[model samples]
Target: MLAALAVVALATVSGGAAGGWVASRDGAPGGTPASAAPVPAELVTAAGKTVPGVVSVLVGGAGGASASGSGFAVDDQQHIITNDHILAKGRNGSVTVELPDGRRFAAEVVGREPRSDLAVLKVPPSAGLAALPLAKPGATRVGEPVLAVGSPLGLPGTVTAGIVSALDRQVRLGDNRHSAVQTDASINPGNSGGPLVNARGEVVGVNTAIATIDGNGSIGIGFAIPIDQVQQTADTIIGKGG
Candidate 1:
């Protein structure tokens, strides 16, 4: 099932599904696993460069309704890019951004486009956030390794690795249709609006949605808004007094 995603009010994450999978380094059946293999050097370098620019977006709505998602710094002006669905759920309530270093600040909505399912926000210049680098338009290739960085289920600064499963995939986002960058990364609630970066630490897309089995958790299928579209939309918004 394809469902719009978000973590509401920082809801509690269930561990029932997590208990089902088991790994063993010694090849023993049902035995606990030893230390996992070392992460590749490229991925380590990518994560190091990416994490600091990502932030946790928390929205507080009326009657205690709220939603959480992830966003990344898009420019030196502290402009941010995130999913519009996150703001829609908040119903025009206050928006707060939390940096990776535990600093929090109020954010102002620059603009939002429902058709693109994208929005722009700006923080004070004092935030001093470093903007993430972006890949060239149409530079992404299938089978290339990628990283999905976000705050899944409210856990901030989380990173998952996978490959670009496909590109130019037709998908419905909100009331509009878009050609998305498909990936096998583990995208869950709170991962919305985060960056799907390439091996060189350059953003290729914005992680937005995932396909689930029988309305369950992610089953390795995820989708992202291509960076070209994101950049265009963000530029348009920022240009108009953002």
Candidate 2:
């Protein structure tokens, strides 16, 4: 029976008939009416632990154009992981990173891998830099609940929640081609390079790009560089300075 159908195609990522799936549902198994459970207190505490590692990144280019993005501490040595786009144009000028406690630092690019849109930056490690843990093996799966922590559109300390929409999705931005973890998280311009965290407060992905809905805002379709790739790339950059 062809019931009321809803075909969810990849809308803006690729301008083509990029295939879709039939969103058909049967019936709830249980007879009792169910109510949504309130969010757990542990989730709130997880966010509290994660946000301290997130930082706001501001870039100023020599041509006078400026941009803002997000990043998070990777280690106690002041190593940071963020989107390469944030440091793309500002290489010749200044890249300022601000912490959750209002401390700011001048960050220097250690390495940038544009293929994955990931970059590594460094500042002198001090007392306040806290490293957020990356999700371990077998820690994630499709439909798993997650959170996006970043500074969206210049507003810092922002956190949004959603579930993993899809996995191993491929998309391109400029010359960068990426296999991303798709989510319905509320990611925006400044959210790039921020952490896409799991419910366990572990960094699972790097929030990269979003598919625009209302002419340049998030309509809950966002893409992220999976943390496995982020970690591999970061280590190569750090150890080899490549």
TM-score versus the correct structure, for each prediction: 0.87, 0.81
- Look at candidate 2 and tell me the lDDT of residue 99: 92
User: Which segments of candidate 2 are over 4 A away from where they belong?
Assistant: 1-37, 89-92
Cα lDDT of model 1 by residue, 1-242, tens digit: 65554221111122112223433334647557689777789999999999999998888888787777889999999999998888887776788999999999999999998888888989999998899999999899999999999988777888999999999988875557888998998887788889999999999999888876555567788889999999999999999956
TM-score, candidate 2, is 0.81
Q: lDDT (CA) for every model shown?
A: 0.84, 0.77
Best by TM-score: 1
Can you tell me which runs of candidate 1 are displaced by over 4 Å? 1-31, 34-38
Predicted model with the maximum lDDT: 1
Residue 152 CA displacement from its true place in model 1, Å: 0.2
Write down the lDDT that model 1 would get: 0.84
State each model's C-alpha RMSD to the native: 5.4, 9.8
